[model samples]
Target: MRFSPVTQLSTRFDSVASDIAERLPDTTAGGPALAAGLGIGHVLVAGWNLTREINEFGAEMGPLMAFGLIGGAGLTVCVLAVRLFYSEFDSKQRWLVGWSAVGGATLFGAIVYISILVRLAEGRVIAEPIFVLSLASGMGAVAGVVVGELYATALQSAAVADRQRDQLEFMQSLFRHDVMNSLTVIQSRAEFLTQDTDGQNNRFAETILEYAQNIVGLADRVERMSDVITGRGEIETSPTELRPIVERQVTPLRKSHEEITFDVDVDEVTVVADSLLEEVVGNLVKNAVEHGYDGSDDFTVSVWTTSTGGRTQLHIADTGTGISEELRGEIFERGTSESGSGFGLFFVETMVDHYGGSVRVEANEPSGSVFVVELVTA
Candidate 1:
């Protein structure tokens, strides 16, 4: 399936975010911090309230009674908050709540402390500093928990997206593997039939064999595409001469596509690439010959390479029906071709990316399209 560049970028970003999320601890895992922050806030508020009550109302009530009343009230509030909000959140979100609660409580305490100090310096009578601090801490804790829970919801959303992407990739891999295996079997049987047939049956067998071979070729392309998608293989780079590689690819293609005129104008330039460079060049040329011609032998495909600064540029231009402006941007993307199984340019792109090179399609002079690939010289 083909995705627009914007969609592709979004998917890639999500994948990366999911990876980072997986490595980090879950949101709810911040249990210790959450517990400590809430516990401390409750203690401060309860103690301060009880002390203030006694100072204002006298010691008619026992210390234990006053303590129980204040402490129990704070505990009840915390219990309710947990039941109403914290319990509703998932594990990943719970961690956000925990940390945010701590931060909120700390921030509240600082604000209250500074306010009380400023008021006292101004000679204004107000609640005791401890009492104010305690109240602030309690409020902050509640606010923090609420905010954290909200943040956790966002995290959960991201996690879900990641899982969906992973599932999709897994399904694609399975489908590719199964289909490739089936194609291989069909190709093998077709080859066997071709070997066993003669006369009239020979023509039928050859047709079957050819189609089966094409299917098998498509399967091979899919397999390579799977490898690229899954990042299963490493690109090994070595200094390689461009002229020989281009010649080797073009020579075989020329025989197969004799109708298309071939032109080579590359010099002997060495560049940093791997064995896959041949595959890259071959696919580009194949695409040109397969799609450029208009049922005539007058189409021309040119291959040329040049070195400038520290980079080498290889150009493959075709004198066939040119790609439309809309298609130019999508030619190198997977599954974007109108013919020839759509994997050719995709493979070229993957190989070019692996070599840290860049490939682009431009309008060829007079007509047709030109594919330019730039690679760093070794």
Candidate 2:
């Protein structure tokens, strides 16, 4: 898939954010809060020792220092919680509500608990309220910035995936249509040559050509699959005469398989389908010749057309080995074949699906197999 300039930047940014989120420490409610509180408590104890050493009359400083220590610890915990929530959430609204509730709860609980402590320590709670308000305001601003950065990073990642999908489709279409056609020509010519001989030299050449064709067909099938994976190749609509399409494919196939009789029964019915309807008919018909007959002496392939309910149905049936139920589902998938690259029916299916048409295989009455493609009347 081709990626745009912006896509590269977006991917890089996502990678960096993912790394940071994975490696950086998490701020759980209890852990960071408890740790910061302990740190603040230690600082308070150290300050109390320093104050006693500095002055003999410093008893009034005790409650004020204690208030500062606990309030500072609670605010630090609040900041850590905000950072953790922002990293976890990408939506602005989710972070907005989450941080507001969490920060408010922690901040208020700390203030209330500390107020009770100050009241009981023979000290006024007036100074403690000022300290609590300052801590909450500072932490809230830091939380806002963290949440904004996380949301911005998320937006960048979504844009990149979309662009990559487009590029993959374009590449698939170019390979499927253009390259597959060329390989089909080579396969056809090789088959014709293989039929025109009876000696060892001719048979060896034909065998080599047959294998070569199979390989080429396989490569073409892979190309088509690439398009399917990327969602790029789509069937286009065109008015196609069923008779001409069948005749064009039949003429060459008939030349290759002289022993096989083709009971062509198509009328001058036209159907709405892609121009590749010719290839679709060709593959089904060729499949019958190669795999259907099973060495039966009176082997025959038949092509006919019928109309019903404003739809044109084209049928290709063969008095040959029929498809087993086990492999039926995979017949239309690329790289499936009785003796070839298995891409023939897959290409046919792709074209049929594109033009809002349908194709199916069924056991022919009495014996053999029947393949049908139904299209909208042109």
Candidate 3:
């Protein structure tokens, strides 16, 4: 088959991208080896230069001083490299600074050695042996400064990440254990009051119980958000049937929002998702009913699922005033909504990402918006 230039270039680009992606993770493991190689190179070049000088000038402080400076600088750089390799400063800047310092030191040493040899060959003793020692010391000092800066920056970044992770973990524990327990007690008391009361008092007790349940739900979401931020939660995938889960979530909404109609048309397909799949579908439906309704009894929400090419797509669409183009762009971002509790869609997005899926917002036919969640079928 004939191929165009663009096609050839794209093929080559994909090949290169695949190669890089496969090798990228192992680059860090190669850091210590690379550093050691550079150190050995410095030692060999410096040793050769010093040996030649010693042959001509006999045993002197110059050759010994040169040997000490090269050995010390190379050892220092190697130690720093090893530290960096094991440290948590996995950043491009750290590698750049480290390699640049090593290159600069080696270049400086090579230039100095060449200059001394050129002068000696011409029978012109340009300066004393002390001059050579001074030059090596200067190069070592410059390399030391660069290595020091790299070490400090790496350490600082690692520390900051650790502190943030610790704080998030503490917050997650507090919410999951302490706050959840307190909310449970309040909900239980409210439920008891609802059971014991009559007439107007009973309605008030039910309202308290409803709000309590909402608070508990909010706490659970907050805990999940903390887990996502700290990267402490592991995604446990399983084959989850979609139709029953969707129906279970929608059934409660039907009772709560009698004014809104829900149309479900999901296939009995299983997806590679966790238990949190229900929360994802529930949030999408709740958000639609809460935001899509315009105080009209004619409001309708539709959910459907379709499978194609090894992927399952679950769509939740609403029939009310559609979202504006501006709002649609930032709607999934946390804290982007006017409502203080803007973590609903954020949780949905995080869970979908964990499940190796994707979610997008699109304009529904005629009016309202549609949330399309695409996941891999197991």
Q: All models: lDDT?
A: 0.74, 0.66, 0.75
Off by over 4 Å in 2: 1-230, 233-235
Worst 10 residues of 3 by lDDT: 89-98
Q: Which one wins on TM-score?
A: 3
Name the runs in model 3 displaced over 4 angstroms: 1-161, 180-225
- The regions of model 1 sitting more than 4 angstroms off are 1-228
TM-score for each predicted model, relative to the true structure: 0.50, 0.45, 0.54
* Cα displacement (Å) at residue 205, model 3: 12
Better of 1 and 3 by TM-score: 3
lDDT, residue 254, model 1: 82
Question: What tens digits encode model 3's per-residue C-alpha lDDT throughout 1-378?
Answer: 999999897577446534543554345545445555566655665677678878989889977787777766666666766776776644443444344455565567677778888888999877655446445643653474365356447556767999989887876787579877887898899899999999999999899889888888777766665666568767779999999989989999999888888899998899999777878898889888888887777789999998889999999999988788888888889887645488889888888988899999999888889999999999
Model 1: per-residue lDDT, tens digit, 1-378? 999999897577446544544665765435434545475558666776677677877665564464564465346446634553446566545544555666677898899888888998999988555555766666676677666556556677767867876886798778877877877787788778879988888788788878877677656655565566557657678998899988988898888877778999998889999766777887888788878887766788899988899999999999889899999888878789878768778878878888888999999989899999999998
Ranking by TM-score: 3, 1, 2
Please say which candidate is ahead in TM-score: 1 or 2: 1
* TM accuracy, model 2: 0.45
lDDT of model 3 at position 106: 58
User: Residue 378 deviation, candidate 1, in Å?
Assistant: 2.3
Count clashing pairs, candidate 2.
Answer: 4
